[model samples]
Target chain A: MENRTAREYYENYLKTTHRLGRILTASVLILLLAAPYVIGIYLKAMPNIPAVLKAFLGVGIVYLVSGIVEYLIYVPMLGAGGSYLAFITGNLINMKIPCAINARDIVGVKSGTPENEIIATLSIATSSLVTIIVLALGVLLMIPLQPVLQSPALQPAFENVVPALFGAMACKYYRADRKAALIVLTVMTLLFVFVPSLIGSTSMMVIPSGALAIGLSYLSFRKKQKTSEGGNEA
Target chain B: MELLAELNSPVMYLICGGIILFVSVICIVFAVRAYRAGRQLGIDESKMKRVITASTTFAVLPSIGILLGVIALSGSLGTPWPWLRLSVIGALHYETQVAEAASEAAGIGGLSIANMTPEAFATIAFLMSLCIMWGMVLVIFNGEAYSRRLVSPSHPEKGGKKKKSGMSGFGDTAMTAMFIGLVSAYIASYIGTIVSGNGMFSFQGSWLPLAVAVTSAAAMGVFIYIKNRTGADWVDSFSVAGSMLTAMAAAIFFGRLIG
Candidate 1:
């Protein structure tokens, strides 16, 4: 009887903490979502809001927008609840939006408490908002000094940063289909290198051309398959 | 000499091209992987349908966006970009350029629209701009498609209970979250322009600001990296980087036209 009572008390305590975390997460998500409009209205109302506040507000707005975008575009297209949950949680955690409950932890909480549904959703949204705001803030704070960055000597190194970052990211997702990956990479490189000169710009054609190449390869595969089937029958 | 210096920035083109290439390669790699996965699943002709749907949707939209951008750029350079309605977008874009130039001429910390006509600015509001920015952000964020479906089996012999609640519905929540995120980012950009007392096209003039911009751009990637512990974390980072590259590229393209 004493052991039963102790177990009940512990369960109650866990439930209470879980509920509290949910509430906090939900509130933060709502605030992050509302932040853009709040800041927009505030800026419009009191134009004299200090530069630092304005900067933070600007950052907050970015986070808010990012949250909205993730909610709207991906959630609808993905259709699966687990996938959606993963996306929300992944976005929150990856975006580095700090929430009391780590996004990955929410997946584990489902077995113990049914309350994780709200916690997972809210925490994911909150984290995404936080990360987006920081990104915007970083850029907002950086734009006033373009001329110095563009100096002839500094240009080469500064320009390498974006591509280098992209390269690091790309290497992380190498395709299992080595041949297909190599073909795509080669075609994309040629487009990036040659098409810009041919079209006198690099902005648009690389993607379409690469896509067309992929399409043609698929067609060839289909034809080969059909030929093999015929040979087998004959 | 000053005008020539502005025009001759070759690094600008290199940066722009490299970013585009990065985006292209990322998209292509994913498309190829997706195709292989579909084939491996051996869903018969259904796999072909998925491929067709994905290729048309993912590959087409960005190509159109880029084509529009190239045409706009050509117009900026006073060269014909050889596309449909080239003149119309070119002219509207030119007006956009003029407005930017006029705003720039007004000078930093100069006459903001609020300062010149406070009442009119208050009355107009940024609802329209907000709507437009939201739309573009939506388009950019939603371009890549990742979806799954569970159809009831065709054979009566393989009967099973009909799915009452289709797909966990987490995708809807994700879409809503992403929309909110992009909208927040858009709002941030707008507010940043106001706070910085500069137009959206303003460039980073020094290493400090450049470093800041680069870090900010990477922040989105870092966020995604942390969220995805395994299995395609790279795509998340690429998406973030892609969005930033798009913004930066758009700003430069506008600056050239306007400045």
Candidate 2:
């Protein structure tokens, strides 16, 4: 995508991707709602409307603010078709986003290119397919595999899997701009330590941490530029 | 058939299986499109193939976790809805919490198949789906604008190329920051409990999660070494998964030994 000509090629294809992405996303929602509808139809039971509202309000309200924030934070990083796929497939922060970043790193493409767009989409789509296949197999094999999946020997690992994952991952990007990564990491860590309850609200915290990282990285960028300019002058 | 006994019944499998199949079809369709786009954009053919392999490998471990989520919820909600939910963006963290909240609101005694009347179960499903759509709706309507604005400052013009920024590009920096922020939040949560003396592992002196993290990071170092020394292209594919699996194993051993 960095090749200027490649971007022009994107212009040729963007329309179809965008239209399909939108329609697919809309259909996913309808199909998702259809789950409950079908269940209700089969059982001859419609949901209690007031109860639905109450539960929705109770569950949905807290998530509403965070959901919007997640959308804003993730969409740009992922790009057009990738966002649609990742959002519909879910597991953005935990799985899809990291998978995308890793794929880009391995393939040596940076963001903001048509190539990057393609890479992100490809990796996420790969991830989604793998997830579905693996899960479906697990569901079918549930009785036989339950012991392995839930083995006490592996329970501890599953419990702390998130931390293990990010520990391996967070080092890659932050190392590029150590100062920024450190600053954001320290601030966020301390904030969470003192306010432990904030752990549940990850979506909201992304904004402030992202703001600080960008702000600090800008300073480092300026210094690096100044040195380069000085070398040129010399 | 009594609804309770049918919680894990064939009908439920058909419904859930249909959703998974649909998601898979969409995923493959887009994957092909992305491949074509990659070729047009001049990405190396081999590199694109490697990306698919790497992503699939990386996805393996997490998919196991997600499967566990479906299994966990199936005991109560039956396999279908949980399968449908987890298959499509319904995370364990969110699915369990929201489902429980809705079940409680519907006055189910607990999150149990026995306690779930069809009506209560319907409410849970509807409310859960209804709530989760906030991000989806935004993506459909305004995703392009939001994403465009994120990178627009660098572009400045519709047809122009990006200016080389002296600083870290906003795209990379913003993403890095968010990642650091998110992981920090997770780590901090564990530490917070420890500092407050509320952490279960602390009394036992294991620092279970931290140990797991360090072990995983170390395992990643090993993976990195394997990648570098062997020049195994596949090593990069397994780095994250290997790190996670090894750490998990270490967590169990360390937890039991010390605690």
Candidate 3:
């Protein structure tokens, strides 16, 4: 009875949310897919279907595997509102996910709450808007700042954004639970060291690594529970 | 006449701008829903406001990286395409490669379509959008389902209580595990990059990236400590961003030093 009202409340939001999310996301996809072809037709430069398919497969096959992995790994982090927004707006692991997590942490909201959803939605939405604005600014400033942007001085920074980001962010989780973090970090390091080519395929490797972490955490959970139960018995 | 003379066509800008406008409109509607829902849940309006401000601040730095990405792509495809693609669904990493692959398939030897036929440009555009559709499809149809699976994952009802009091501990461990897993997968690549080609294992190349990663972790450590001692959660809020900026600066410094 206690949770019934809240659960029902969440379910209500879920209904309207799913309905709106699907419609909005679907529309964006349709527009994006059609834009290229429509432009081609108007310009009398319609894409050759064979050429399109060949080019697509060349790039598509890897993402075909990697994309699904990202959705599975990232959806839980993004929630419903954030998902529609992020998938449509793009830039997940590097930008939106970090923004959402920071927003949630700032307010100390746990995951899976309406509050968490709000923080994530607000953060991601805010970040996306910021990104678009920055891009618009970049479009205007492109010629003026062209030399600075392409300068060798700044090349290393942009090239290393992912490593710079994850290195800092990972410390938070590692502090929270050393056992799980250590195991995952160790395995990831060794795997990457032995098989350096795996660096290009990091997105694809998320599942296997995440599974190993989940499995280890579950074991730790069971161990803690068993010890606590034994303590109570004693 | 000089504005978009060569590759920056007027029509391209119009279409890209329209798409950006469409996404912004949808974004506002969703934010309103989440905002109202927050108030209903007894969340302080001020707290939500802070999340907005902090998130916006944090966003500025990473968005700079994305800006660099746009600039790189523009050199090849021109401004309108990268601007629209990156602003919408494309990532900084994927768009360049996707364009190159499509261009190559179209028999444009190099990735950039500078000497491009309109047909080749269209093919590249079409392919970039097509490859990214996988995640968007799931979000449209399966987002809510994923959330349901996430928030309540077969951890017995425990008197059917609505609060996560019962499974919060379980949730903490499981969620931590998953996050660490994802982060490790990404971080590992940096380690691999350093060790494999030339660092420890090969002994043939530079490990400047490895130094960047270590410096980043150290900076984060200092910020996290400041957060604990000051009890100013803002320090924690900015810790990750702070660390990233420092590390990026270090990359330039270290790149000059070693690599």
Candidate 4:
């Protein structure tokens, strides 16, 4: 009876999250377009439809695929409320994802639990708010901070932010399953070495690498199970 | 450049500022809801506070990186638009690429402010706003269903008893694998530059990124060691943020040494 009550609460919470998520997302979408439309109208310089379409065709088609792929790949990890806020606020790969993952790990919450969902949402929300505050500060201080921010001496640090971030993250996560990590890392390294252009497609590559790791882990699990069974028989 | 001046005008700032304010309010609302739900779920208050503090710390450096993106784009796209783009749904690289493509397609010749007109700005804005909006749309319509499907498989609520499928930890393993795949690909590409003598960065063939990554990984190792030894919970909270800043600082030293 307690389990049933818990299940009902979880279901109701998800239902409320979805309802709120859809409404807020739809509202934000309108506001996003409204920014450009209001500007165009205010300036009395509306966009030419043909030119907009042409420009969109040049890049939009590719990003359309990317948008869909990113949604599918990231949503599972991000959970419900987290996904809604994250998609709206953006910067998933660099900021939101890492923040959510770190919070979940720190609190020792398993993915797919109510605890995990709440943690992910809290972390993502906090990250988003921080980003907004930072960006606002940047805009206010752009003049004073321009030289420091745009200095040649600082370019390397900014350029290498991804490596620095992921390096630390990888260290933490790889310890969980060293064997799978080794196999995936080696295979990915070899693949990149051969087809260097694939460097640009790291997001898409996660699919195959994840599948390979899962397969290897499953095999290891089976092997251990069989070993225990054989020892019992002996 | 008349339009460029107007683009950065007070009205533009107001619009961008308003949008950011709206987004911020939503963030606060969600955060509040999540915190209440967490308390209901019996999460320790201190743990949730730690999550908030750690997330705030982890966010600072990356947010600065994004600020730099705004600064970069502002040279061509004006301050307000780039600020809005970076603060909201757009990334640095994507925003740059799309703005360039839209400007060129609009016959503005590129992302040069000299040739930017209202019409061209409008074109850029439309393309930038339209193309990236699909992700939000997908999340709106499909996010709940997708999340339900993802969690139901492993959820204890779905099955009253835990199943011993020998696949107990696969979700975490998969997440870790994806991250490893991402980092390895990045590290390998940097190494590949050394092998092929061609890379995307100006300092091609230099071991800059790989060296930076190694230094960062070492820093992380040190943080983890310290956390284990001292039993300082704050070390755990600051590990990633501290490692990233240390590695970024070391990047300057490495850049000078290697380049």
Top lDDT model: 4
Q: After superposition, how far is residue B239 of candidate 1 from its true place, in Å?
A: 16
Q: Highest TM-score: give the candidate number.
A: 4
Every candidate's DockQ is: 0.02, 0.61, 0.64, 0.61
For candidate 1 chain A, which ten residues in a row score worst on lDDT? A91-100
Best by DockQ: 3
Mark the regions of model 1 whose C-alpha exceeds 4 Å error after superposition: A1-127, A133-161, A192-203, A206-210, A213-234, B1-259
- Per-model TM-score on C-alpha atoms: 0.30, 0.91, 0.92, 0.93
lDDT digits (tens) for residues B1-259 of candidate 3: 2322434887888888899989988888888888887776667998899888878877887888888888887777778888999899889878888888888888888775455777888888899999998899987767776777665432235222564343545765666787788888977776677677554487444466666667888999999888778888667556777888999999998877754
Worst 10 residues of 4 chain B by lDDT: B195-204
What is model 1's DockQ versus the real complex? 0.02
CAPRI band for model 4: medium
Task: Report, for all candidates in order, the number of backbone clashes.
Answer: 58, 3, 1, 0
State the displacement of the C-alpha of residue A19, model 1, in Å, after optimal TM-score superposition. Answer: 24
Interface RMSD of each: 18.2, 2.5, 2.5, 2.4
Chain A agreement with the truth for model 2, given as TM-score: 0.89
Residue pairs in candidate 2 whose N, alpha carbon or C atoms collide under 3 angstroms: A1-A115, A90-B89, A221-B167
Q: lDDT: which is higher, 1 or 2?
A: 2
Query: Residue B102, candidate 2: how far off, in angstroms?
Result: 0.3
Q: Is 3 or 4 the stronger prediction by lDDT?
A: 4
lDDT (0-100) at residue B201 of candidate 3? 88
Instruction: Give the per-residue lDDT of model 1 (tens digit) for A1-234.
Output: 243553454344334433432343233233323322443353343122233234334332543454454434333222222223223123221122212122222222321121232233333333233332332232234245334444444333333333322232233222222343454445544443332232222212333433443454454455666787789999
lDDT of each residue in B43-109, candidate 1, tens digit only: 2334233223322322222223223333333322211111111111111222232223322332323
